[model samples]
Target: MGNTYRRVLLKLSGEALMGDLSYGIDPAVVDAICAEIKDVVNTGVEVAVVVGGGNIFRGIKGAAAGMDRATADYIGMIATVMNAMTLQDSLERKGVQTRVLTAIEMQEVAEPYIRRRAIRHLEKGRVVIFGAGSGNPFFTTDTTAALRAAEISAEVVFKATKVDGIYDADPKVNPDARRFQTLTYSYALEKDLRVMDGTAIALCKDNNIPIMVFNLAVEGNIRRALMGEPIGTLVGGSCGIS
Candidate 1:
């Protein structure tokens, strides 16, 4: 718990912000996550969050139909901005210093995605939330998360999920699916593990940033992950899964 990660990229799925509600943003869930972030920020851990847009807009649903791919993706990016604004407001209301940086610029509300600016903000103990999903199409928030992690030079990418860790199969669907405490990148690939998409995994592996997939739905899991605890599936190069 002592300085294992000076900086971390926490990836939260849009679904995580849904909380007990049905759609859009849930203030309770956002506040809970911010509380966890504040706990680690007090520990001097620099936090950069990459948030998803599914809670408000699912681009895939539109792209799957006759919708133009770029247009759908643009809508998805806008959704991320809404989520960022919600989180930013909640964190600020909690007395936590926060910044919202978007890939697609919306200067009236937040700063543009400038790596140096982001690092500077982090140095000043401001939690940075990255929105807008890489400002392009044909890319999921997962891919954006990897890209930002590498850019921010985060030691680890914590992918907050519904499950505590990776399993050999869908544990929810398959009761016998074994949960792996750790896994090797090769095994994850050789076995076709669905922990992450191939593109996201490849980026993390290529950049040597270990990905910790843990269940954020569980109380305090985010803090545990930031503390570098062995609470999730750790995927990285040579280190395998842990």
Candidate 2:
């Protein structure tokens, strides 16, 4: 079988699972993602996921109201746990084996984050979902995705975004903006693209892991991107798409 990625770290924003709705989890949308993930698994790729909690709780929202950033971050982490549980339920109900590992020590609820254990689970064909966003303040889940992808030596960091790929400008705001089929990290930064936060980009660069930005809402996009099809912008060391 042709495989572009043997192992991948899927960075799913909570908002993606919300579909077109304004907030909270959307069952149909989440199911679609689970289906896509399962299809990828059938292709012999080991998947690890890092899901963000922006749909339920964004730390910045609390910080804007003078709440302590650290406290707000912890709240965000807990929200991620909720999302993880929901995802685990969705996947298992569909007959897939899954595990939710949290960064915080919640012995009764989920497994504590351990690099080797997580990797072993992936090697055994189990879907490992990582939540809780680094278990600390002053960091975003995007950074957590990069760190985890590197820790497990994932071939690519798949960022499931709302847009099809990284654009020179926000396609929604700018009708004339163009989507890049491939990109270099330096060019993305030089052009001031905002596909990911600065810290996340830094982590990927430091680890030499490429980031593939694609719209998760787009049907079959995830599987197509995983097979190395031309579906999104690939950015990082030696993307080989110049």
Highest lDDT, which number?
1
Scanning candidate 1 in windows of ten residues, the lowest lDDT window is 233-242
lDDT of 2 by residue, 37-151 (tens): 8888888899999999989999989999899999999999999888888888888888778999999989898999999999999999989999898998889999999999989
Q: Against the hidden true structure, what lDDT does model 1 obtain?
A: 0.88
The RMSD (Cα, Å) of candidate 1 is 1.3
Global Cα RMSD, each model: 1.3, 1.4
* TM-scores, each model vs. reference: 0.96, 0.96
Give lDDT: candidate 2, residue 69.
Answer: 90
Distance (Å) between predicted and true CA of 84, model 1? Answer: 0.9
Off by over 4 Å in 1: none
Per-residue alpha-carbon lDDT of candidate 1 for residues 1-242, written as tens digits (9 for 90 to 100): 48689999999888899987789777888899988888898899999999998988889888898799889999999999899888889888888899999999899999999999998998899999999989989898988999999998989899999898999888889999888887777787778787777788888888988889999988888888899888978888866443
Model 2, TM vs. native: 0.96
Clashing pairs in 1: 182-241, 182-242, 183-240, 183-241, 183-242, 184-240, 184-241
Clashes of each: 7, 0
lDDT of 2 at 11: 93
